[model samples]
Target: MPQSVDRALDVLDAVAASDGPVPAKALARRLGCGLSTVYELLGTLTARGHLVRTPAGYVLGYRVPSLHLAFQRQMRMSGEVQELLHRTRRAAGVDTYFSTYRDGGIAVLAAATASHPATGGFTVGQDTTGHATAHGKVLLAALPRAARLRYLAASGMRAITPHTITSPERLDVQLRRVRHEGVAVEVEECAPGVACVAVPVPAAGAPTAVSAALPLEEFHRRGHQVAEALRQVAAEAATFQGTADISGSTGG
Candidate 1:
């Protein structure tokens, strides 16, 4: 059986699928639900700013801007995030990347490489487990509570490294620390020799993320220096094309 909240969400979906904002009676009929249920659901969705009404009919709310913002965030990250990765890689002479949380895991969308002791660079479309990488950890740390719970539930607690958090409770402790410190770290979670440091890229008005990935020794030797450059570039990049989701802001 459908749950109450699910029913409410269904009502919203019906309205959203409509050509225009629909009146309550027509909306109820379209949803194949009773008037009272439809009315209650519409009220709830409207209150959440996800649905709205106009002179003609019920429609998606003014906050369609927010949903657009989320879509824009994903696209922005695809293009501009690569720039940040290049900046950090160039400045620090280290491998750098941006990863986003995807399907209960982390996807490495872009990466830049600097010759460190003449090491090779990472390419695009390389996906990894969020539970196993520095970038993933930072993204995990930044997840909204509900999203985080959803990820942990689906991915389950497992050990990919000696340093990896094998339990949700322990992972929670570290994630809390990441939230407070505004950084996430991994000693050997993703690779034994590679240590990484990461930070979040907030999406106040759009899909948001945390950016990370680095080599351990050099990162420690000049982390603050690289990080300062990364932060500056991140800030500048955030202002790009008016596409950056500054509204999805995380307080500095």
Candidate 2:
């Protein structure tokens, strides 16, 4: 690739990985490039609608979501994964979600809803806090101790609900158990009256997870069944690794 192209891609990647908008100077420092070069690239990217530059900083532009949808359409899931997700949702009688830890947060990749939808309030492409959701906990648990601590500090450990874990020490213990049990569970942590259970799918890299959600009442009554169903699907998903390749194939 041309050097300019390489640098532009670097700039894009840095912005995409950031938790929020990134400034030009910060991009230059992170890319180890001159300020002038970063500025030129930023300008070009912004003109092309690949990035949006504001007083705060540069963020991914509107074009990115369209491109993402195009790529996802192109990267259609294999029959097995789709069937498994659907079957799990049907069997578990709740909403099933496939999410991944990316750029220091949660990305819900896909979801299958039950015929009688519950009030879990989840959707595809939804960004979620890493400290309050079962899927987030699975991802957090996979991180090295230092990185996990840094993320918690950056997140400020804000509580999403009364059940959310706001203390880093308490959450650290929970993350350890997530690792040991190969699963994570949340009881109204992310949202009131909603509960979730998730298991790690490291095969996709970056701590991807699959989860099932239902009402707190149903969860309390049949937590074991829901957990078992989620584990089965997660184990199957753990054998799959093509998602990252598909997502990256279209990258510059």
Candidate 3:
């Protein structure tokens, strides 16, 4: 029963992650399950109003929106936190982000680009590459030891850029340094000319991190200032809850 439940949830996640309606066969391949199993689960989910079948394939049902709305409301971060991100953007003169580590993935909840906007485009709903992102490193480092190991094993270090960490052993060392230093820094790791610095928020619910991205030149010159600004925000914000235990998976 537990295994069935996991597969059902996996099906839902796959559908959600997809750009459009997904076929049963595709889902089976994605989940590594037989067609019969996927068809049965899809039927059950569609019947239960958790999925909606379309001409092309299946998408989330109406019920999913309400659930998403509810989750958003539950995670409605404080105005102060939002303001802090904005302030950080202005202070650092770069694009700023508020992210949470959930389900073994980094979910960008809020982003602010002030007068000095960054060249790269990133925003909410984007599941960032953990192996190449400072925010990802902070959150990944905060995971429980066992879960972190499981996540690392499952998440192959895919190289987004030539500078991206591709070795698990090297990444493990980097994560330890991030934890010890209480900060994460990435220089041209995710993108050629983009650099990022992140610091953990230590929120009540989930492990949250705040980050600022800038051009490589600016990041090199004022990275410490950005980190300080993020630390100030983390210091002043009231405690909040939403982050749950680490999910034993790695992000895409």
Candidate 4:
């Protein structure tokens, strides 16, 4: 790729990762590029409406939303699949997620939340912690051993929460259990008080996982019920004609 385009994307990523608007100097330091180069890229991106110059610093601009919306449209689930997700959410009484192994990472394709506010907000993008999330575990369990190891090596097992499995040996044991039992469960691994259960979607195309997330106490009390609900919905979703395949090659 061209150096200019690469640097522009890096700037965008840096801004998006930041908590609020960030100045050019911070961006330069983060990207390890010169101040002048950062300014040039920022000017170009600002003119293209990909970044906006704010009083504080720079933030993503209006063009970003359009791109996000376009991506959502392209990955939108069919009515049948959407209905199945909602059904799982209703039955389990928790926020539901549908995900797949895509482009060497876990991508949350769609989600169905409760009518009222749920605990954690779902970010529709690549998820890095395959060792921590139930859905991530499900997707990782589907990969061949070598490919799985490569993914793990690339995406380190960071401890998101205290309960997260940071050891490769421990994660391997759990993944084996997921493959044998055909379900993955995590207790407060991804977040402080959240627990999730996931099951593989036995669809023909992309390797997919459907999961339900709820409070830790509720999960312990009704874990079996939620896991069953997710499995049922995943099975139903597999039969749908246009279940989205948001996956790429599972190569090492």
Candidate 5:
């Protein structure tokens, strides 16, 4: 690939991978490039509308979906999910999202914040444990059973909360259920008092999952109904499920 464009994209990735806007200098170190190169990349991407400058620093832009839409809707469905989350927050009360595969985990492609009546909570760029998250598991379910078994064995599902599946056996069971339901749930897993319901947004070009997270207390009160709402919202998003290819396979 062209080095300039690659560097520009690297900067964009760094921003997307963070919970908040990231400074150009920090982006420089992570990409193992010089400050000037980082700024140049940031400047270029921002100019092209892929990024924006914020008080926190630089963040992936909300317009990303529209830019990637039409041309690579399949590949860019993830961004549409984010855009949907941002909009759904108005209806579902925010706290909704779309996630995609990244570095053996799920990346937040889009999110809306109705998580609280106020501000200050997990940001849009957060990445959660694949096994622990309801949405994450939905994507995980797409993996071949044989490969899924191996991933769980090595990942050694951790106990994020009492509700989390800490064993391979239990995790496997949950994944099976997710496959059947076409949705996943995180009840106090990944974070205390946090729960999520998710559905797969299948796009062969750029596949991801659509999820809605809420305070655990609220989730228990509304998980079932919200799961349906999530489904409806997903209907508005693109469907993309490419062939299964979990990055690193291991033995179960």
Candidate 6:
């Protein structure tokens, strides 16, 4: 890829990852590039309507929503599957996510959350912290042993929290358990105060998983209920013909 395009993408990623609008100086610092180069990229992106400048700084522009809608359409997430996710959120009383492993990465295809959401970190796109997320664990557990090892080698097990299992050996043990039980659970691994439970979405023609996240204390209190709800949703999603194409052309 061209250096200019690469820098532009890095700028977009940095802004998306930020909690709020990011100043141009901060973007330059984050990208380890000169102020002039960053400003040039920002100006082009803003003119293209990919980024919008605010009094505070820059945020994603109007074009992003259309891109997101196009992405959702390309994913082929049917109404039935989306409804199932929403139903799981209501039944499980937690934020729900639908995800799949493709091209050696995990992507969250859909999510349903209540007015007061529980999980805070999940976003659409490639999720890099597979080692610390239940949805990622379920997808990782489905890979062939060699492929799984290769993916782990490429995406190091960075510890997101103290409870995260950073050691590959330890993670392998958990993956084996996930494969055997067809479920994955993580407590305060992905984020502080958050616990997640996930189950494989059978017959989805990809390494797909449906997960629910809630407060750690609430998870402990109603973990079994949440897991059961996720299983039910996964089973229903498996029956949707549209789900067969959810992975699209992306290889598992």
- Using lDDT as the measure, which candidate wins? 6
Model 4 alpha-carbon miss at residue 88, Å: 3.5
lDDT of 2 at 193: 87
Give a tens-digit lDDT track for model 5, residues 1-252: 498877887777778778788988788889999998788778878888889998878988866866545423433343455566677878767377666664444556555775342121344444545778876688778776665655566566777677777777777788889888788887777777677788876543333677877777777788888888887777777532221221222222
- Deviation in Å, model 6, residue 81 alpha carbon: 3.0
lDDT of 6 by residue, 1-252 (tens): 498999999999898777789999999988899999999999999999989999999999999888887877877767687788887777657888889887777889888887433374787678888889999999889888777777788888888899999998899899999999989999999899989999999888778999988888998898988888888888889888877777632333
Off by over 4 Å in 2: 1-68, 71-80, 115-118, 241-252
| Model 5 poorest 10 in a row by lDDT | 242-251
RMSD of each: 13.4, 10.0, 7.2, 4.4, 6.6, 3.0
Put down candidate 1 lDDT per residue, 105-179, tens digits, no spaces.
555555676543213223344344566555666777776777777766666766776777777777788888878
Please report, as a residue range, the 10-residue window in candidate 3 with the lowest summed lDDT: 241-250
Can you write out model 2's per-residue Cα lDDT over 192-241, one digit (the tens) per residue? 88899988765564567888888899999998888888877877776755
Question: Which pairs, if any, clash in model 5?
Answer: 82-110, 89-94, 94-114, 95-114, 202-239, 202-240, 202-241, 203-240, 203-241
Taking all chains together, each candidate's TM-score versus the true structure is 0.57, 0.64, 0.64, 0.73, 0.60, 0.84
lDDT by residue (tens digit), candidate 4, 109-188: 77788643344445567878878989999999998888888888889999888899999899989999999999999988
- Candidate 5 ranges with C-alpha deviation above 4 Å: 1-75, 78-80, 102-104, 115-128, 153-156, 202-207, 239-252
Order the candidate numbers by lDDT, best to worst.
6, 4, 2, 3, 5, 1
Candidate 3 has a TM-score of 0.64
Total clashes for model 1: 13
- The global C-alpha lDDT for each of the candidates, from Candidate 1 onward, is 0.62, 0.78, 0.77, 0.83, 0.68, 0.85
Give the per-residue lDDT digits (tens) of candidate 3, residues 1-252. 999999999999899878789999899999999999999999999998899999899999988867755655556665556676777666667788877766765677767875333443455654647778898888888887776666666666788889999887798899999999999999988888989988887643667788888888988788898798888766655354323221223334
Q: TM-score: which candidate is best?
A: 6
Q: Candidate 3: where are CA atoms >4 Å away?
A: 1-71, 114-120, 126-128, 238-252
